[model samples]
Target: MGGRFGSPLFGASIKGFLNDRSALEGITSFGSFGIGITGLYEYHLYLPGVPGLRPFLGGGAHVATGRASAYNPYADSQFSDIYAGLDGVTGVEYVFEDIPLALSIDVLPVLNFPGRIGLWWNAGVSVRYVFK
Candidate 1:
């Protein structure tokens, strides 16, 4: 019951983001690279006898930052914008003891200041390392 079920977790990941609005007009695209780091606490909730899958929930904070540059032909100006946001995440994960790794994907909509609603999507993989 305590093999891969009892431990504190930590990980880092790189993601691509599609900002709804940017400095340019008629052009909204996903990021080339948006990197982030995370720290999390996970707890197992399923019974020991369950052979199917183990479910767990985690909560954590993530930081993402990126820069965008675009050329506006009409305005004849090059605009560069830097974007950064902090997000709070809560999601479920599935652990399969048959394999040595656990895979998880979570929707971490963020609250970014200086923007409307500031809801951004963040989803990625988390490699788990269990400790006794």
Candidate 2:
């Protein structure tokens, strides 16, 4: 569940992720999927010197249910981990003047706590339609 709000230069996201559990853990043996929700606030700095290009920065929170590997001196096991943490985002976007679409590429780095205490990166491209 994800949607974009606001104008092309600035926006917010209400989104969720359904990810491959193994991919999330950076392993191949893990089988399952993970579900999570995220909220982000973004601000874009448009360069007047260069039209149609904007660089952005954002911060947000994510909460999810997934499997993460827990390590011990004696044994390591996969366990249910809660992903409740903060994420920082940075990206660049280009607005198409002929069309109502804005294309962006962003990288999100997360720090989890109370469950999986680690850092992970979620990097992807997104397309948004402008209402105005």
Candidate 3:
């Protein structure tokens, strides 16, 4: 699991590759604000001679049912309502050759529908244990 930049949310993400260039990720997060789940689709771009390094781009959606303290001004600290949003991800990752591990750093910008329409920055770093 990894923590977010602007908030105290900690999330667990699992990614599965569909092909050499594409993958999908499912994420679950929890914090003082509440708990949330996100899903994303990613496309990997290879760098020549860099066997395990790649840059990726993707988009996804999230559904959350709890209080959140983003740009919501309805409540003093948070909004007690169900939230749905669109999210985008861009990142670079490297998989270790000798070890079953991967490391990535990414920026996830989210737009809360029916709420915050403007994108908010959400940067994070994550490590994954690859199962062969």
TM-scores for all candidates?
A: 0.46, 0.66, 0.84
- Candidate 3: worst-modelled 10 consecutive residues by lDDT: 68-77
Candidate closest to the true structure, highest TM-score: 3
lDDT tens readout by residue for model 2, 1-132 = 123322111223422213311101111111243445666666667687787787877787867655543221111126555547787888887777788777777777778766437776666566666544
Model 2, CA-based lDDT: 0.53
Q: What is the C-alpha lDDT profile of model 3 across 51-91, one tens digit per residue?
A: 99999999999887666455332223355666778999999
In model 3, the number of clashes is 0
What's the CA error at residue 28 for candidate 1, in Å?
Answer: 24
Q: Which model, 1 or 3, shows the larger TM-score?
A: 3
Q: Which stretches of candidate 3 lie over 4 Å from their true place?
A: 1-8, 68-79
In the predicted model 3, the residue pairs found to clash are: none
lDDT of each: 0.37, 0.53, 0.76
Please give me the total number of clashing residue pairs in predicted model 1.
Answer: 0
Error of 2 at 24 (Å): 25
What TM-score does structure 3 among the candidates reach? Answer: 0.84
Query: Which scores better on lDDT, 1 or 2?
Result: 2
- Top of the candidates by lDDT: 3
